[model samples]
Target: MGFLDGIRASKSQSNNKSKPPNNHFVAKDIVFNVDYLEKRFSDCSDIVFRKIKSNHKTNKDTIVLVFTDGLVEGMSINDGIIKQINLYSQIYNSKKINIDLLQNLLLVNEINRSNNFDEIIENILSGNTALFLEGSDEALILNTRGWESRAVEESSVESVIRGSKDAFVENIRTNTALIRRKLKDPNLKVKDLKVGSRSNTSIAVVYIGDITNQQLLNYVVNKLEEIEIDGIFDSGYIEQLLEENTYSLFPQMQVTERPDKVCANLLEGRMAILVDGSPDALILPIGFIQLFQSPGDYYERLVFANFVRLIRFFGFIIATTFPAIYVAITTFHQEILPTDFVLDIAKSRVEVPFPPIIEVLLMEGTIELLREASDRLPIKIGQTIGIVGAIVIGDAAVRANIVSPTMVVVIAITVIGSYIFPHFSTSYTMRFIRIPMILMAATFGAFGIIITWTWLIYHLCSLNSFGFAYLSPFAPSNLVDMKDAAIRAPLFGLKTRPIPTPKGKKSRK
Candidate 1:
């Protein structure tokens, strides 16, 4: 048989109904006369009949038929739907059990809304049942959209030491509500968009209507509209689709779980998008400095916050360049080393046959492998793997002369520094960029390092997160926003938002 015939035959067999004359009959079948639907699906087990009693004894003549199962348990029908319907009937007793009256009561615009096919199929599948009557062409679309969901829990990956313990859950509405609950301003608007062609995932773009730029809002909406994917399971999907520079190692958008962090961004005039299934929300108009700033910073004293921020900045620098510096110094800048230190290094590397680059690569690769293995294992087991692997491999490799002891130290320090970054995405991006830096350092020493830095800066300058530069408050150097970027000055001191975003967003009150 042909394709249309084959599809019709399969649907007929599955539904146990004779195929209508036209190829496009099934859709129209639900649209035709209400009696045909009633007769075809009348005795279905999921169907129920609820009638109105005029007096103490039942009035069978003026009965309202609800083709759903009984409202109790062990039955497929829902109690809530029945309760709501009965409540409505008691309130509106004048509008008795009739087709037009029920239709009007249910606010159904047309006759097809209460048809037997749509009511029985839609309501039953949604855990309610079909509602039909002797003469009505319409049925009430009962709200039985019930499904179980998990409660919000603290974020395992982005936990803070001093900040709020509340984190996001899988529910987008709940997540948005959490933000709304915290910031009870009418101007804080959530624009919902149905993303993912298949998943139809509910995504909400949240921002302060007055504070956020209208141009930026339109840009973001246009970008979202351009996305034609089958599924967007996480915020990362939007990040990937909307990022200005996809090839750059640096992240253009910042994804976080904490509502406080998202709120902070919104106050800075940045837009936040929360996806239905993912706990993480993507914050647009993010800069390079944002990844370095943590939620704990604002929750602590300025002195301690500044000290911690400085440490993180240093950590990122050390993480990116420590191994490369080791390779460069050992291979090309040996003359710059102190006499005793040079002798010690020479002694350490004497037994190693491979060059310093090769030695560094070996140790770096081993550290990366250990890190990956540790991350993939369970918490307890992952800790064990990290400890055992670091000790056994670092000690064994050093003793075996597979890599120099100093090189092992550099690689370990690099790995630790990468972990110290506040945002996981930034840390991951830094981890990836490290290899290229190492290669460049090995090829051309300090000059190679300089070239890499210059190239990175160029890329950063080119990168934009929903029209706002990724290097904002640094490249443009906004003195006003600088207080909150490099260091958490004081809660009161942050009187203005990041300058790259729309102005007047930040507040002292």
Candidate 2:
């Protein structure tokens, strides 16, 4: 009874948070006064301010509009707005006006009056203008947001050899347009959500209407609604927040810079999230096979794609476990190797003071250091670092017998395998997972390696990305989905979607 009571008390206390309760706040309650708003936002480096005054005899009101930096270009006191203000002034004075005047005075700009504080702030942040009337409590917000942004370039991460050259930009609207340009169906829906308490990043949830499962869409929405963070710097923040397991090292949400890749996921009935200020968009309910897939697979010939896929799959295994397997076989099961090969390996290690595991750790660590340093340096310097570091370090270490020449070959092959694994993010993940394999090898040799592998499989099986099983179309066995998983079948052979969630009303046509 006491344990249960304690648990209930803890839950109650957790529910009573210190943050502001979620509730409806009216316009008056939310908006700071125009002057206050300016003062508060003036210090912000990104805020832009504009002042527009009425030129009519009756109305002496000044419109103070604020927007994000560089979003609004030119503000003109045009005839339409001036005429509308003149009529409003006359009405305020209880003066008689011509009946035909209403049509000309009633402008399209009246949509601005419907703006509440939240809407005004939303518009302002999005690079739109928020207007403040001197006598009125409501502010007129205009949507004239535009700014200089980096032009769409070839995707840096998911570059295709033969497909589209255009990649997603930092602008959310432009990114949506890129996808919309490719997929021109009206069924493609984009739902907007404001994430991040401080950053207030604009995020768009996009999916095909008839194809996507409603239950899964609602689940994603509910998960996003549950987030209470102050800021979301990247798609990674939302990924971690919405994921089932916080402790898992494996990424549940897949991010891609390519619009085509996002379109491909949407066609498979998965949801895509586009965040403002980020070129990369998150694809939910991604399977392990999806991570291994390259956009190049869909662009090139089937035979070429299949060959590439096979190489990647082989590379995956070699990159992840080759070092561990080598260490295990050499240290504990030397009989597995040929007698001559064993003799050669033994002779190579004669001058080395460290054990096999230490030699591997030293070599792998140096390689990683060189790789990281090269990435940070300028492009020209980066090449220099790679060439000079690899050549000088390998020659010096092998000749000095700090590490065996055989060990050098194994490490070099492992590094090369990691680079060829299609997705750099997944390759990085595998690289991180390699350390544990090395540790396991050192602890209990072959048995430890097997145990580690089993644990990894169990964890992968347990993982669910946005309610879809991570190891889908493999662990449960879906024949139709398998056509594009391990091997790339011909385009005509793939006649169905990957089945991300439960079957909906729409199937592949």
User: Each candidate's TM vs. the true structure?
Assistant: 0.80, 0.85
Q: Kindly give the stretch of ten consecutive residues in candidate 2 with the minimal lDDT sum.
A: 22-31
Model 2 agreement with the true structure over 1-509: per-residue lDDT tens digits: 54223333444455433322322222221123443565656778887554443333322244445767667544422344444655575565454333233324534343355335566666777666665543445565555656789999998767778888899889899999999999999999999998877778889999998878899999898888778999887787887788888888688888789888888888878889888888888888888887778788887888888898899888878888999988998889899899999999999899999999999999999998999999999999998999899989998999998999998999888988887855577778779878899889888998988998999989989888876788888887888788888986788876777776455333331
Candidate 1: residue 169 Cα off by (Å): 1.0
Estimate every model's Cα lDDT from 0 to 1: 0.72, 0.75
Instruction: In angstroms, give how far residue 246 of model 2 lies from its true place.
Output: 2.3
Q: What lDDT score is found at residue 503 in candidate 2?
A: 54
RMSD of each: 7.4, 11.1
Q: For residues 1-509, write the lDDT of model 1, one tens digit per residue.
A: 74223333444555433334533212222212233444555667655434443221222113233443433232223234344346665676555455445445542222235434533554444344344442343455544333456688888878888878889998787899899988999999999887766666778999999888889899898889889999888888898998877887877788898999999888778789998878999887888888888888888888998899999999989988888888888889988989899999999889989998898778878877888899999989999999998999899998888888888878878888888877676787887778888999999998889999999898888787776767877877677767777776677787876765555655741
Q: Which numbered prediction scores highest in TM-score against the true structure?
A: 2
